[model samples]
Target: MAADRGARLGFGLAASVLAADVATKAAIVAWVEYGARHEWLPILNIVHVLNRGAAFSFLHDAGGWQRFFFIAIALAASVFLAILMRRPGSSQPERMAFGLILGGALANMFDRIGRGAVVDWIDFHWGAHHWPAFNVADIGITVGAALIVFHELFGRRRVSEVNG
Candidate 1:
């Protein structure tokens, strides 16, 4: 019963977060253009951009192979996440974290497959210092990763407790 509940909750959170992430990306595409920026604050801006590679724009400059490679990796990661979610004794936090990670990966992968690039827009800067432009899916991945790390570090059930 607990496992079933965890699966439902995890999948629900994944669906909502992924949908919001994708929808926001689509909105950025519709309302913003490449090389354009809308200053929301002195330190924050929304700039339309596309990435053809992985996190932090790794391999972003690759000619064409990056798309295939990234898509393959995202699909594999999503599959592995699904398998983990199905295993008995999966913790709720771990399941939720993995679901978010999988959803974010798949969302970005869909964009790469459909548009040949991942859409990015949110930007932050203070004078000359600037952070990398990112999007909703990236945010999900980062937050999910943090949650996973926290759960592993502090939320795990001890082996003795599990056996008892």
Candidate 2:
């Protein structure tokens, strides 16, 4: 029963993240012209850019094969995450982490299928340096990965202490 409840919670969170990611990307496409940038703050800008490759735009200019490659990876990751979320031993945090990663992967996969690239808009910069532009899907993936790392570092220790 706990496992079932955890699955439901994970699925629900995944759905919410997916919905938000899709909506935000759609809005960016509709409102921001391709290659155009709008200053949002001293350190931020809203822009429309298409990434045809993996994170940090790796292989973005490597012809066009990277698109399908990334889609395949996302699909694989989504399947793995779904399986992890359904594991009976998975705690709530672990389930949530898997859900977030699954949602982000699915969102990016859909973009690769429908748009031929991932739409990135959020930009952060300081002076002459700039961070790679990313979207909501990236946020979910990053945060989820961080959560998993945090749990691995601290959660296990706490559990062991309690058992002792």
Candidate 3:
């Protein structure tokens, strides 16, 4: 009973986050266009940019090959994450981390495969220094990665104290 509830919690978080990511991307596509910039802060702006490749825009201009490569990579990642989630004794935090990563990856993968690119909008810049434009799924993966680190650090401390 408890295990079922735990699984649901992880899956629920994943579904919500993934849906939010996809919906936000759809909104961005509906509203923003390439090179159209809207400033939210002196250092932050929303400018639609479609990423046709992987992280750091790798192979962004590989004609059409990048599409298949990226889709395959995302599929592989999702499968790997599912296996990790099913591992015996996986804790809630671990599951949540995997869920976030999987959801985010799948969201972007769907866009890349269906649209041939991923929509990116949030832009950060400071005095000519710029960070890559990214969308909600990117944010999800980043936050999820941070949470994994948090879990590893604090989770270990708690376990040691309890067993000590």
Identify the candidate with maximal TM-score.
2
- Give candidate 1's TM-score: 0.93
lDDT of 1 at 65: 97
Q: For residues 129-150, could you state the per-residue lDDT of candidate 3 as single tens digits?
A: 8898887788777877888899
Top candidate, metric lDDT: 2
lDDT of 2 by residue, 1-164 (tens): 99999989998888888999999999999999999999999999999999998899999999999999999999998988999999998998999989888889999999999999999999999977989999998998999999999999999899889999
How far does residue 146 in candidate 1 sit from its true spot (Å)? 0.6
Candidate order, lDDT descending: 2, 1, 3
Q: Which stretches of candidate 2 lie over 4 Å from their true place?
A: none
> Distance from true position, residue 27, model 3, in Å?
1.2
Which ranges of candidate 3 are over 4 A from the true structure?
Answer: none
- How does candidate 3 score on lDDT? 0.83
| TM-score for candidate 2, residues paired by index | 0.97
User: How accurate locally is residue 80 in candidate 1, as Cα lDDT from 0 to 100?
Assistant: 88
TM-score of each: 0.93, 0.97, 0.90
TM-score, predicted candidate 3 vs. hidden true structure: 0.90
Report clash pairs, candidate 2: none
Ranking by TM-score: 2, 1, 3
